[model samples]
Target: MAYSSGGRLPFESASKLGHLNVIESEWVQSLLKDFETNDVDNADNYENDIWESFDPSSVQSLNHIWAADGSYVSVEENHKELAFVKTALMTVEQGKIAAIDKEYPHPLKLQEIMKDSALFHATVFPLRNLKSDKGNIYDTVRHVIYDSMRTDENGQYFETLKWLAYKKWDGQKNNSLSFECPHCSKVIETGIPYDQDTGICPHCHKEVLLTDMIGFHLDMNEENASDSVASHYMLIMEMLMLFTVIRLQWANKDTTLISDTLFIKDGPMTLNGQYSKLVPNIREFLNFAKNKERPIHIIGSEKSGSFFEYLSLSSRFVKPDPGIIKYAVLNHDYIRRVIQRAPDRGNPYGLRTNWGEKVFVYLDENTHMVLNMTTGGYDRSDAYPKSSDIIGLQRILATLPALVSRKYEGALYPIELVNGIASMSNYPSAKILQDFVRDAVH
Candidate 1:
């Protein structure tokens, strides 16, 4: 590799794989044919997911909002990987806004806590080739999960773990949790009470933590798992933090607060891969709360994803009138075939994982909301359009107009603030956190 006058004398890396084999490969040609086979089946299927002549639902607006967002960064050096995750749950009160100084543009502004927000949870993982306090990263990861779900930053009862246990057993303490033992592979039903975090499996006589139901231990071993597992934990913690706030409001101080609060999650209300086992319990709790009449109001907005991209392309026809808030109910089939480009095998999309149904809300000209909303229960219906099944649909939709953000194409104000707090910028954040980790290891 030599630099000439133009600084362009670098040779390409040698490859014995061969570029010509890409076309000659039989499997590559078969994959292309498979994609072409389903091209027509995934088109013109928007009738059921669309809503034309619709007005936003009329319900008492909930002014208080709890928005959650998180960031995960990892550093790998010397054959060791360390990951840091920070999640922020910001509480924004709509009633706090007041108009002032129209000329100076201070008409309405949220208080700036971007530099140092107190309402955040931080966790570290020794993902690979590293030792933790427990002598093994596997147990250390377990301990970290246990610690966060058990308490807030102030070391009080956060109750997210209890909430997980509470949801697992019919949203009540008088029930029992069922799980298959990893040691013996036998189904065990334990009535260990909801408050307790860890218990022994009756069948195998082995220790089982409440967090074991989350399935993180499946991939994690003493040998060392990938640092990518930290991102999955970040997602779980984001939801856990949101639910911790909601559960506290529902059970502890003011139960009425849950009704007046709008919960906003940055991404979809989904638990992917191994962590998806909690979906049933999540729906159970939502239904339980609805039956108790404290009914939760939550929605997840996707700023950029395949669904957002799909809506951007099809926005013209489905949502032309800016004045009207047109929406589409995304069925599992459309998601699987058209959006996801997978085989639609007649099962609900994210059935075992997602707690909310994906809906595209066209809010005026510039903003569109890709909301993952729950209608007080799990989505079991194979029905094409599920707009009618959504409880408090109008209230959730009506509340969004105030929360929209003009900074990005599909943005929300609350989510933006939380993202800023939770975000880890590469310039200083990564370098600083990595340095801290290196120094902390004596």
Candidate 2:
């Protein structure tokens, strides 16, 4: 059962498991009662002091702050030193502080901060002893006062522990969406809000579903907390990709940035075993891209899951005939190549060699084919087919000008021919080949 911010009670009254029933009904109620009592006491104190010390001017500013968990260093003789450094940014209004935000380095670092002796626990005694010489004067306070107020120590440790526990609870929860569409030659951005669906593209107008989008709640727990963060990160990446795509469409009209741009998911792109929810969402975005004739590129980190398998499965849904879409399992070596080559030329999207030659087309390069997946993928794949199989497909497509022309068949004859060649060479299932051919002809 879950509660919203508005304080609505969950419909399910009883927990299915007997052990949880006691914890949920009895133990939780007791804890809530205790919390309420403490709140009442705090409220009384606040009310009592409402006028005596409530000078608005003395309270310098109210700021929002965020903290990253911490880092660890192993010193000589097998000694480990845990150092927790939190980054705080102040958003000030005129002269007052407005907001501060913090994020944990990684979920695991929270646990490390709690257990380590060198950081959190070491400052308690000194903090407790700190006091101002002139207690009532705020300006007279020294560094010790700031240190005591700024550092959490025990609270940080406990908060980290609580976050880890909440993460555990979140892991059991599931959420995601999915869709289907033809493969386009351009890069497509899916998961667009329905309100923003209409487009000026010559091929289609009003291309997205207004009501198809849904919000999902994820369970939080210790074991899968990291996984949850990774999933959220992927969602953010997808959003960023959409932003980049939109920027290309209306703002920049650049193809090279879209083509050469690489998005890195902190973990593998695989959706784990929870496919029913996640896959459909991914499919929906891909389908939208196909309709828009856009190529979508994604890469996952070393910690990525079965993303390759998922991509392989998703590839089947893409009509091979259009030859608009292709995906690859990019490992660390591939990512390293992109990073290394980014520095040499005046532009990042120039001629850079990875496993083979790769031309980084900027956002402006080849504007006509910038968002077209079939043409762009073919062009890029032709330049840098990561594997021999992809290279062979490109070679076959390159031969199509001799067999066909740009007359009645559309400018996509080359793409269709390439798909046919790929199907013939790869010998995929009959259903897949037939689908590919159908997509190509249509």
Runs off by more than 4 Å, candidate 2: 1-193, 196-252, 255-257, 272-278, 284-294, 303-442
Please name the candidate that would achieve the greatest TM-score relative to the true structure. Answer: 1
lDDT score, candidate 1, position 41: 29
lDDT of each: 0.67, 0.24
Give the CA lDDT, 0 to 100, for residue 9 in model 2.
27
- lDDT of each residue in 240-300, candidate 2, tens digit only: 2232222232122343323232222222232333222233334334334434544333322
Residue-wise C-alpha lDDT for candidate 1, range 1-442, written one tens digit per residue:
2212222211111133335557556776554444334332243634334554456554566777778899898989998988888887777565442121212324234433222232667778788888755568777776677676665444322455565656632534643356655455576675355677677888778877676666676667775756656888888888887886665666544557678878899988888776777677777778778888777888998878899887775665553565467777887766777789887576677777888888888877666778888865655555643787665577777777777775777778778767877874431221111222233212
| TM-score of each prediction | 0.77, 0.22
Clash counts for all predictions: 1, 47
Runs in model 1 deviating more than 4 A are 1-49, 57-59, 96-108, 112-118, 154-158, 168-176, 180-193, 203-206, 252-255, 424-442
